[model samples]
Target: MEIDFLLVGQGLAGTALSFRLMEKNLKCILIDTPLANNSSRIAAGLYNPVTGKKMVRTWMADYLFPEIEPFYEKLEEFLGKNFLIKKNIYRPFLSVEEQNEWMGHSSDPLLQPYFEKIHTQALYNEVNNPYGGIMLKNSGYLDINTLLDAYASYLIEKEMLMQEEYQEDFLEVTDLGIRYKEIKAKGIIYCNGLGAMNSKYFSNLPFAPVKGEILDIHQDFCPNVIINRGVFRISLPNGLQRVGSTYSWHDLDTGPTERGKRELLEKLEKLIFIENKKIIHHKSGIRPATKDRRPFLGKHPGLESVYIFNGFGAKGVSLVPYFSKIMVEFLLNGIEIQKEVNISRWNQT
Candidate 1:
């Protein structure tokens, strides 16, 4: 079988790129392995424009935020599924000083787009917000599982998805393109998350993998918006509230740990006053982070038709949609990728 591109991995990175390629009427095939610990599958799926302890706007928030809803809405229409949850994010201030600082930020034109409202007084009676918090607009979580599953079905129906492990050894790089057994493609792009670390071409790139754990707990407190402070608490369907996530670099092999659970509960206690919360599930996955915390995007230095589109790390939900368009443009139009994200920053292409 011959195709234009062979995408490795069907996680958010692969899914977004493949979908964009198909939208442009480009022929491609995706090879994926559904691992129990796939990062995208187990991710919190939260996309907050304002993040961190300083509550500063995230990197490239201006570019990434606008593309998110429009991109996902189109996917939803195509798949006939509802997975985008456009809810506000409520982040409580740690102190009165912080609250006052945000009051000034509310007027900053650069920050005004994401600012919903700055509450000086407590917004909810059930929560602990003595200094109140900031309500951010254009912030929410995607139902990643629903999106991935629906897209997988769409790919399968179109004969563009192969649900199996991709053996790198079988791949052959030629002057024309690439060959994997009977499959021939004009180019091959690696969107396989940390799986790229094992590839011969990408192993040299610095990939700082970090493992994160999240919990699903049954609680009566259901807020319309996501509560994010020390730890984020997102209200899901039914009586369950999704709370997470702790980052660890050493404990990559282990799944969810008792230490991670304790850390989450301890953080949760500081954010809200709750009683008798039942833990329904605990899951974890290794993020394909980089030393510089930017995504890796570009063609291989030596191989003409080989490329990579991975390493969005914890911010994949926000980064993928925008960068996927950029990647597709580079692939089809020979447009030069931005130096910041291009892998050639490390190696000359």
Candidate 2:
């Protein structure tokens, strides 16, 4: 069957892009394997507006953070499921210097939107924050697994999803467009995350893959707010909390390792005053990070009919929603993509 676009990989990136494409009256079919190691399924799905050691506003927070909640909420309404949870993130100060630094940042007009309040003392007894913390508004987590499953089901009901692996051997590029097996499309977008590194079309792009792991633990006291410092601890509905993640550039495997668990445990212990926390679950996934730390978007340099919309890294939950809208607009209207994220920047070298 002929379609407007063929999307590879049904991870969060592909799901968002496909949904946006269809919303614009573009016909597209997504091919996915539903692998157990799929990054989106294993992601902690946290979207923080303020991040990093210095606790600065995340890149493009002003533009990106606004689009996140509404997009997910709209999808949740359309899919008949609730996965978006808007919550405040409490980041404890590591030292007096850090607290003083934030004291000045809290007053910045640009940061007023995300800053809720800054505490001079600890907020909760369970959290070991001696130097107090900063409460960030407009931050939360997305239940990615639930959202992906619900959206996949929606696509299946609409006959827009195919559960299969993408075979490049069967693909043929024509002057009109590209054809893969029985499917013909005017264009194809690669959203296969780390798998894109193996694609002959996009492999040359500086795709730096990083391995991340998270743990699900049952503790005596679970705080309502997400406690972040050394490790981010997100509370679930049950008497459980999700804490993670350790970044490893060398070990790229998907399996949960002793070292990863130990590292996370060490960080978790440092963040919260918890003893003997029962480990319920452990998971790992490779982030499709880029060398420049910006998402890779737009058409391939050599193949005009081929394109990409992946490499969201650990911030996929935050980046996907905003970039998908930009990508779809570029796809449909020939609108100029933002130069910072446009693939042409890399191709120019």
Candidate 3:
């Protein structure tokens, strides 16, 4: 089979990129063995404007937020499902210093519009905070599972997606093009998430796949907003709240550990106002993070036709739309990748 593009993995990165390419009349095949343990599938897909311990706005939150909002909304229409949900972010101040730091950063004229002057007196959750925290006007969740399944189903219905995994041995490289199994393509794009660590074209990109666990509680006590206590709490669309996610780089195991459960429970119990909330599900997956924690995008320097669009880490909801478009433009045209995200920065031809 011949196609214009061959994509490995069906996570958000691959799905978004493939969707963009197919928009330009390109035919692509997505190869993957759906891992229930895959990070994108298990992620809470939370998008928060105010992030980090300092409680400052996320990097480029102003630009990225606006760009991502309409992108997910459009995907909802294309996929015939809702992918993005908007909500407020309630951030608890852990200390006086932290509160002061928020005061200092809040003065920035650039950040002023996003700053909340009135301290919220509302205690939606116990949150371990006696003093009320500030509320970010814009924050919310993306339905990663729904979007992934919908895209996978879309491809399957068209017979363009395969459930089988790819083995390198079957690949035959020639000056003509790259070949894997019976498929020949003008080029191959590696969007395999953490699996990209072993990719021949991009293995040296310094990926740090961090493992995180999220607990899904079936309780309705979860407010309509995402609550962040520096380390936890998120709101889901279906009235399910995700209190998580515990980050661990050393223990890269995908299995949901007893430690993760215990830790999450301990932290979550602090915010549960309702007495009888029940545990619904526990999911663990490793995010394909980079050393700088920025997304990795663009084509390989050595191989003109080869490319990558991975290393989204925990910000897939915020990062994918912006970079995915840049990547598609780079794939279709000779668009110069931003230096920060270009693949060539880590290596040379």
Candidate 4:
């Protein structure tokens, strides 16, 4: 079968790009391996404009934050599913000086858009925020598993997704396009996360894989807004709160460790003062991070039809939507990708 694009992997990166491609009336197919431990499936799916210990604005927050709600809302409407949760993120101040510092930041024009409100006194009685905190707008967590499952069902109904392992040996790269066992496409983009490390096309790129573990705990406290500081605590549908996550670069395996669990618990204690919390579930996945902490986009240097849209890493939830549109533009119109994310930035030597 001949198609415009053959996308390998049905994770967030592939899913977003495929949807964007289809929106432009392009014929595409997604080949995904049925892995139970996929990173997208286990990600916390939080998108915060302000992050880190210093509580600074994330990279490209101006460009990325605006596209997030509209993109997910449109997709939710198309799939007829409700997976986007629009909740403010409340981050407590570590000291009075920090609170005073944020009070000054509230007036900055550049940071004004994301600023919701700043609390001077304790907001909740169940938590440990004695100094007060800052509430941020346009911040929330996406129910990724729900969205992926619904999107997968839609793809299956549309006959656009193929559930199997993609074999590179059968792939043929020609001057015109690419050819797999029975499929012929004008181009094939690899969105297969760390699986790209095994491909000859992208193996040279530095992929720093990091393992993260999250826990679903049955806690009595259910805050309306997401509490993010040392660790993020997101309230789920049931009487459970999803808390995580610990990052470990040395251990890249997708397995939850006792050390990881201990780390999360210690951080969780600092974030909140909750009692009678029980660990209901523990899960882990390895993110396809890069050395410079930017995504790999654009076509391969030597092969015209070969491209990669991987390496968004832990920020995939926030990065994919905006970059997908950019990728589609580059793929259809031969528009140039931003140098920061372009794969061409890395020297093959």
- Compared with the true structure, the alpha-carbon lDDT of candidate 1 equals 0.92
Better of 3 and 4 by TM-score: 4
- Ranked by lDDT, the better of candidates 2 and 3 is 2
Report lDDT per candidate.
0.92, 0.88, 0.79, 0.91
Question: What RMSD, rounded to one decimal, does every model reach?
Answer: 1.1, 1.3, 2.4, 1.0
Predicted structure 1, TM vs. truth: 0.98
Q: How many clashes show up per model?
A: 0, 0, 0, 0
Tens digit of lDDT per residue, candidate 4, span 240-322? 99998888899876579999999999988877887678999999999989999999998989998999999989999999999
> Between candidates 1 and 4, which one is better according to lDDT?
1
TM-score of each: 0.98, 0.97, 0.91, 0.98
**How many pairs of residues collide in model 1?**
0
Report lDDT (Cα) of residue 173, candidate 4.
100
Cα lDDT, model 1, residue 242:
92
Candidate 2 lDDT over residue span 77-179, tens digit each? 8899999988899999888898898898877999999979999898888788888999999998999989888888888898888888788888897778999
Which candidate would rank higher by TM-score, 1 or 3? Answer: 1
Better TM-score candidate (1, 2): 1
Model 1 worst lDDT run, 10 consecutive residues: 32-41
